[model samples]
Target: MAPKVLFVLTSHNKLGNLDKPTGWYLPELAHPYHVLHGKTDITVASPKGGEAPLDPASVDAAKDAVSVAFLANHEAVWKTTRKLADFKGKAADFDALFYVGGHGPMFDLVDSATSQQLIREFWEAGKVVSAVCHAPAVFYDARLSDGSLLVEGKEVTAFTNAEEEQAGLTDVVPFLPEDALNKASGGKFVKGEELWAEKVVVSGRLITGQNPASATAVGEAIAKALGV
Candidate 1:
């Protein structure tokens, strides 16, 4: 049987204090899904149980073949995502947990108690807990069984402070991803040589990607870790 992977997406559609819309980034979710589609059993989920919103800017930014194919062929998976809370205490059912990123997660998933609980469960179960780009925001408040921050001393990367500024959302986001991860990891957060460079860091069972360009590699990392 293929490994079971749970893909968590943000439900918040509105960007922080702005009229603009945001949700999961298209390529961050689509590229990984495209890579793992046949090799694993994926369960799409969100904080809310219904349709997961897509970041409109990402849709426009990522018009690649993989992203376009995902939007066209996998509507059903994301359109009706499972409620994240429903998976509580059920972490043993899956082999990995993946968080999809966008500006929206910085608002909702970052401080979500349910999300924090799920991350703890997955970590304690010896399963992979991974996220890409801004999705690592979910790790901001997650703690392990020992009550230590999940990313503490763990090598991790996320949408960098520079990239956030490049996107012109430095002041708009609830918190900067790179700064938050660095603090969470006790300054262990690292980045690629340049902005938008593809970088995937695997610290034990935790996998993180630096930006949208790293999404596909993050998925491949998950597949390799799972031996799928």
Candidate 2:
């Protein structure tokens, strides 16, 4: 049987206290969905369920073919996402858990007890746990069976401080993803040559991608880890 993958998205839609709209990054979800949908059973979920918000600026279908296709089919998937709090499936039922990111995750997933528990359960069960860009914020409080931080001593990468600066939201976001990951993991963070460069790190079954550019590679890494 093919591995089942759960795609967790953020329900938070505001950009900090600015009231600017923001949600999951389109390419971050689109690229990975395109790559893994066929190889694995992909299920979408969010903390609040229903229609997870999309970052307005990141919704350009003209940017890539994957984005175009995803938008065309958005209604079917977006309208039916399951709520993470109400998901009936167990961690063992899925082979992997993927967190899609935008500025939103930094607010909700970072402190979500449900998300933290799920990540811990998935990791402890020997299932793959992966995230991209701001999605890594989910690891902020996740712990292992031994109670050690999940990303502790693990090679990981996410949206960097420089990249946040480039996006000009360094101060707008609650906290910098790279900084949070480094502090939470005792400095096991890594990055690429420049801002937005594609960087995917696979530390055992824990996979991470640096930015939108790294989304597809992150999916490929997850597929490779599952031997699919």
Candidate 3:
């Protein structure tokens, strides 16, 4: 049987108090969905559930074919996402857990006790754990069995501080994902030479991608780790 993957998306949609709209990056979810859809069974979940919001900036159909295709089938996929709080599935039921990111996860998943538990459960169960871009924020409070952070001593990557500066939302976001990961994990945070360059780091079963451009690569890494 193919491995089942749980995809966690952010339900929060606002960029701090700026009133600017923000949610999961479309390509972050779309590209991975396309890459892993055939290899594994996927179920989308979110803090608030329902239809998870999408970052307006990531909706350019002209440039993102996978995202465009995902939107075209939004009714079948996006509309059916389950609420994380309500998901009855156990960690052992799935082979891996993936977190899709945008500025939204920094606000919600970062401090979500439920999310932390899920991550811990999945990791302790020996399931693959992965995140990309701002999704790495989910690891801010996720602790391992040893009480250390799951990212601690593990090679990882996420939305870099420089990338946040480039996006000019360094101040707008509640906290920098890279900074949180660094402080929480006390591990080396890696980045690519240029902003948005595809970079995926795999340390054991933990996988991370630097930015939106690294989404597909992250998916591929996760697939390989799962031996799919």
- Point to the candidate with the largest lDDT: 1
Q: How many steric overlaps does candidate 1 have?
A: 0
Whichever of 1 and 2 has more TM-score, that candidate is 1
lDDT of 3 by residue, 5-67 (tens): 999989888999897898888889888888899899998899887888888877853267777
Q: Which regions of candidate 1 fall more than 4 Å away from where they truly are?
A: none
Highest TM-score model number = 1
Off by over 4 Å in 2: none
Position 192, candidate 3: lDDT:
89
What RMSD does model 3 have?
1.5
The CA lDDT of each predicted structure is: 0.92, 0.88, 0.86
RMSD of candidate 2 to the truth, in angstroms, is 1.4
Please provide, for model 1 over 1-228, each residue's C-alpha lDDT reduced to its tens digit, 9 standing for 90 to 100.
999999999899998888999999999999999889999999999999799999989989998999999899989888999999999999999999999988888988999999999999999999999999999878977998898999998899999999989899999998888888899899999899999999999998999999999999999999999998
Lowest summed lDDT across 10 adjacent residues in model 2 is found at: 71-80
Angstrom error of the Cα, residue 221, model 1: value is: 0.2
Q: Candidates ranked by lDDT, best first?
A: 1, 2, 3
Worst 10 residues of 1 by lDDT: 136-145
